[model samples]
Target chain A: MPMPQVPFDDRGLAYGDGVFETVLLRAGVPVLWDYHYARLLLGCQRLNIPLPSREQLVATWQSPPNAELEILKLILTRGSGGRGYATPDNSQPRLLSRRTPFVVNADRWHEGVNIRICQLRLGHQPLLAGIKHLNRLENVLARQEWNDPAIAEGLLGDADGWLVEATSMNVFWQQAGALFTPPLSQCGVAGTLRAALLDHGVVQEAAIALTAIHQVDRLWVANSVQGVWPVNKLLSETGVVLQSWNPAGHDRLQVVGHELLGYSPTSR
Target chain B: MPMPQVPFDDRGLAYGDGVFETVLLRAGVPVLWDYHYARLLLGCQRLNIPLPSREQLVATWQSPPNAELEILKLILTRGSGGRGYATPDNSQPRLLSRRTPFVVNADRWHEGVNIRICQLRLGHQPLLAGIKHLNRLENVLARQEWNDPAIAEGLLGDADGWLVEATSMNVFWQQAGALFTPPLSQCGVAGTLRAALLDHGVVQEAAIALTAIHQVDRLWVANSVQGVWPVNKLLSETGVVLQSWNPAGHDRLQVVGHELLGYSPTSR
Candidate 1:
């Protein structure tokens, strides 16, 4: 059966003129609601899209029965309009949500995961930076750089050769036991977990140059769905191990801070 | 009444992972079919999308009754899939077409139009630079820089400060009677009309510096739907005329060369 779809003229589909949030729903509750809502609000404000009230979002969260884990994604866009890039004056914002069963990656969460460097570099646009907008072709193309099952993620650097992020996660690392993550003022999506970690003060924001990737003591990747996972290996596009690490105990602190919703060890 | 919409999971909506073509249909026959098809093919190939055969497009073009001029927009998107940046294996491309009544802009065509320098400097990403992909928020934001009816278009400069193109059209300028346009190697859409003009040996491709805007003798904008339009005045975002041109008879050469799809004096 066909599912309901967004109107073709919807700006979200047409121009990618919208924002989205991917929430980790555990037991029918969207984890990190405050962080996700904050990011969504910021995205809406930046794009000048009238945000839906908090009550509206609360109503959406009430749907579907309690479950162990489900990926709840919400997309908010400038609604249906005629052809042209200029937004319509009376345009209404449309909000859409979907939920999908998420199988926790027990292997990656427990044993750590391998990631690769993407040849595709992110472009700098401060206006659209930090928000998780729909204009994500860079991520799509970066992800295309590797297809090996062993390669769990791809790291993307900005055009200025600063490590921006992993394909779908925020990248963090420790050097001399000092933890830091890339600042996203120029480019890259500001993941909710990254924001929480920064707010939690356990992670400091810094510009990690792409040339210094190999100098890090330990690497970690985090997102709302997968939580924080220690990066076990770094691979080149050709599947060559450029750097290796034993992340078993390295990410223990982040996991122990799981009470903050930034860590999820779904090792079932 | 609601029209059919694209599936929620379509990668085009999700990641802007697709390409599109906006054509002008005259009496139900698509104008510049060859150029449009060629560009579409290139876009599909660049993104690794399977192109619908020419026959399929021709069949689609057969729809709708004969009309003077209607906008024919065809959007090809990677089909529905799960939440992830990776292009799903064996993903099929979905082709969608819509025809919009195009009121001939007789005034702008005959009297020329006003254009502005966009405040938003487009980011540089060579990989997705030239194609008319779904990721068009830059253009969208640039279009939002002005709302005056007198401003027909806004010109975008790249991150390196080169005049890339107009918000929705290819830009051309004549200096000392030598026609030239900015190269799209770094960024900006390669319009079909721009390609045709380049092929016809009328306009030469050149790197146009944003600082050189005042050095141009005359300016023009071109696209498949609107054809060629003389730019009479260049304005700042505040509607201040930074530069002005009396384009009355200067654009006579382009209009006379309507043999190419570059001119459409829709004065009716």
Candidate 2:
């Protein structure tokens, strides 16, 4: 909030050496604050980046509460100077938070959006599997696989043909009447909303193979900032529809998103 | 030299969505500039980030030429503004250059260093392999495996036990009088010096198994900054020497490094 202590040579910029959290704020209150805060803390701890007190993070916002939703980003870096990869014995962690306007299409909540499978497969690294660290070039590359405005998201899998998650959100699929999400032990960011859902027993972890993608009947993508969106279709690179799902069967799942994000079908 | 156009929310800072080059500058001239430039261009091209003109990059140095050697780091990032992973249509590239005094242990050039195998193994991602992108948490975690000043570098291998490289340098080993280094088509940074060596036909690529670590009588680690360091001994986690190499047989290999870096055994 104050002039960031992160210098030009900060490791975060140099080597992607940090963790970040994106919180959706509504009327100065963070939606799913407990889940987001817990993940932020876990990420910092996993990376050995000493975290500042909760008061320090909370104090970053000085603007008056806006009635509308806004995006708040928190970045905690290991700070500068360790001669390449070595952590400085006396390293001082840097904490930075920025608030920006939030924008979303309310229709997507009910109308759903089409998604695709990405060509780029995520490599396995259990040490960094679940933490939302800054090394997200894989996600960036997967997201860049398509620029078509109609295609809202892309599904990513590991090298072993196991589904991981969507480009910017955790993915859940329904075949019978239960919900299943990919396990993040091998790779992928452990989204806060996904964690909250698992904790509440709303979903179960399962390994979905690439060959079985079309077998599932219903699918949805979600994140803390975007809430939830039912995936209406899955398209191939050549624009052929590979799979489709009906929103009628998945409308009940949307209720969980509304309760978690404090959103309704009419709210943006 | 001008003020950085990168904002607090730049993609590079947010996701490490960029490439970097660390050049050893000797008397204002960049050592191995061509190889470094080529990799930089390849990285930007691979990520679809437009690169500026070569002359513009060269112009970032405003200080008078110094006779002493220094480290020059150039970072080029996909400039801000993209909906999560969707790149902005007219995204501008940001280039930043910083110079810091270079320091090295000259004795390591001749006396060599002791090394160890890292506990962490690199994940296979051919798409991002060997490009020197900023998603380098693997290297950071590998380097953190040890704090012993005696262990100059950590050797890294893939999940299948095939040797990849070291934390900060490309690795080379001599087997039966022929030089062999790991192929980085799956992962690891394809360093400028390593490319130069391969270009000059000074070395050949081979799949060195982790079990063959002790079988190779000679090993060396190299990069542009420190030139090269021979492995005098290989230590296990318990501080026991797993293998030892005689510098007398590998002094010829060090010559290749000295020639490429424009350094003499006597020079710093």
Candidate No. with top lDDT: 2
Give the lowest summed-lDDT range of ten residues in model 1 chain B: B259-268
Least lDDT summed over 10 consecutive residues: which range in candidate 2 chain B? B1-10
Give per-residue CA lDDT, model 2, range B1-268, as digits (tens).
4324346667788889899999888877888999999999899888989987988788855476654788888888887764487777777877888777776677888688999998899999998999989888899888888998978999999988999999999999988889988999999999999999998888999998987788996999999889888899988767789988866543655787678888875432
True contacts kept of 2: 0.64
Chain B of candidate 2 vs. true chain B, TM:
0.94
- Clashing residue pairs for model 2: none
lDDT of 2 by residue, A13-100 (tens): 7889999888888887788888877878888877888778888888866577654888888888887764488877887877878777
Lowest lDDT 10-residue stretch of candidate 1 chain A:
A259-268
Residue B1: error of model 1 in Å? Answer: 11
Candidate 2's iRMSD:
2.4
Which residue pairs collide in model 1, if any?
Answer: none
lDDT of 2 at A124: 96
Q: Backbone clashes per model, in order? A: 0, 0
Name the lDDT of candidate 2. 0.84
lDDT of 1 by residue, A143-256 (tens): 877778878888999999999999999999998878999999989999888888888888899888877888999998878777677888888767678789887664643664
DockQ of 2: 0.60
